[model samples]
Target: MNTENARSQPPHEPSGCLTGVARGIALVVVLPVRLVWDALAFCLRQLWRWVLAPVGRALGWLIDVLLVTPLRWLWEWVLVPVGRALWWLVDTVLLTPLGWLWRWVLLPVAKGVWWVVDLLLVTPLTWLWRYVLAPVGRAVGAALAWAWHIAGVISRAVGRAVGWVLWNVIGRPLAWTYRVVLTPVGHWLRTWVWAPVAAAARAVRAAAREVRVALFGGSR
Candidate 1:
């Protein structure tokens, strides 16, 4: 039992020693980085608290004093007064005169011009289009439609007449000639001429074969 305990204890001692060494090395490696991070954080805090904050406050004060106050003064005093004066001047000089001219002079003249145009141009044109042009266009259209219908009828009649004439004069004669003359002639020529010629050709071939067989003393 003691021997076994000694062996196990030796293994655990080596592990503990290794653990201690690893921890010491890790602490040594991390110490400088931790110090550097802390120092940087402290510097950033001090910079924000002392330098940046006071400077931002001073800049805001300067802007308020220089830009914002002056602009507010200009808007309140200079711009407002000048704008009002210019508006009053425009209203009294230009706008008033223009309004008067438009109301009294231009309005009546424009109405008279419009009335003259309506009377001389628009009304006469409307009357012409309504009474004269519309009736004439309708009459011409009707006449053209009637003429077109009559022409279509005449064309159809002429086409049918031509077809009938062709069928009677040319088509019927050609059909009769083919049926009455050509068909019988073709049949007679085939039966008498072609049959005898084919038979004579066959006989000539047979006689030549026989003569050759006799001369050569062979079957073919």
Candidate 2:
């Protein structure tokens, strides 16, 4: 068992030598690239911190001095007073007069026009609808209902009369003819004529059967 274990153990020296060679090669290949990356990062940080930041700050200050400050002053001093004066002028000149006219003249005129329209048109129309049209409509409706009732009565009476006439004139005669004439005729034919004919046929058939038996002899 000890010899078998020794035989199964794997060799390690060649693999260890190969691994060391690979690590050395990787270090040699990566050293220059790492140095170049570090240098580029340092340059970018310095450029942003010193050159680009100072330029941005100078530009912001110049813009504030040249454009923003003057515009702010103009808005605070010139535009505000001009706006206030214009608003005052408009209020005194236009709005006050228009308000006064609306309150004094136009309001009264509008009220008068509305009053005239209501008196002339609305009142008359209301009276006509209430007193005349409504009553007339009710009367017309009642008359139409009465006429319809009368028509229904007349129609019913006519139908009853027609039904009575048909029964007396046509139905009774047909019933009597069937009961008196056709029934007796049918019974007599069945009793006398049909019975005699049937009896004769039976006698002939029997005679034929006897002659056949006499000639041909009886069945086996």
Candidate 3:
């Protein structure tokens, strides 16, 4: 049985070491192809960079030349002339006639208004001053003088009572108002009127300085 089994298992065929040799040859052949592929990729990248650089610069220069320079020139030359022409047309055609109309028509109307205002305000004020306020003020002065004598006698008797009432009721509020609002308002009134005067004085001073510089060699 053992002899039959040995005979049935045929001898192992000779191993094929040629497959390993074929694999080594294939690896050696692929190495140069991979190197060439990597070299081509690098060259393509370098070429892309070189080409894009000039294209970007040219695009930027074209934008400036086409859009920016012409716009600036238009603003400086064309727009200015157009604006001046429009202004001249307005002054000659529209504004001149309007100004004439205003002088001829509207100015008389304004004068009429001023006359009416004077009649309403100044005439009444004058009449009141002459007829009512002046006589009433004189009468009040005379009456006050008479009352002052009587008041002095009574004040001597009731001085403490009047003083207490005024101190409690009126004096504190009056003092507070003077300190908080009236004092600042008085200061502001002086400043408001004086500031313009000061500005005019400063302008005069500047003109004098200029004149001095021109005449005296800036020594003053």
Model 3 scores a TM of: 0.33
Judged by whole-model lDDT over C-alpha atoms, candidate 2 comes out at 0.92
By TM-score, the better pick of 1 and 3 is 1
lDDT (Cα atoms) of all candidates against the true structure: 0.96, 0.92, 0.91
Per-residue lDDT tens digits of candidate 1, residues 195-220? 99999999999999999999887877
User: For candidate 1, what is the lDDT?
Assistant: 0.96
Where does candidate 3 have its weakest 10-residue lDDT segment?
Answer: 10-19
Residue pairs in steric clash, candidate 1? Answer: none
The ten-residue window of minimal lDDT in model 2 covers: 6-15
Worst 10 residues of 1 by lDDT: 7-16
lDDT of 2 by residue, 1-220 (tens): 9999878878653577898999899989998899999999999999989999999999999999999999999999999999999999999999999999999999999999999999999999999999999999999999999999999999999999998999889988888988999899989998999999999999999888889888997852
For residues 139-192, write the lDDT of model 3, one tens digit per residue: 999999999999998988698888888987899889999999999998997799
List the candidates' TM-scores in order: 0.59, 0.51, 0.33
What candidate 1 gets wrong by more than 4 Å, as runs, is 1-65, 195-220
Candidate 1 lDDT score at position 166: 100
Roughly what TM-score does model 2 have, to 2 decimal places? 0.51
Name the regions of candidate 3 deviating beyond 4 angstroms: 1-77, 92-94, 151-220
Q: What's the ranking of the predictions by TM-score, best on top?
A: 1, 2, 3
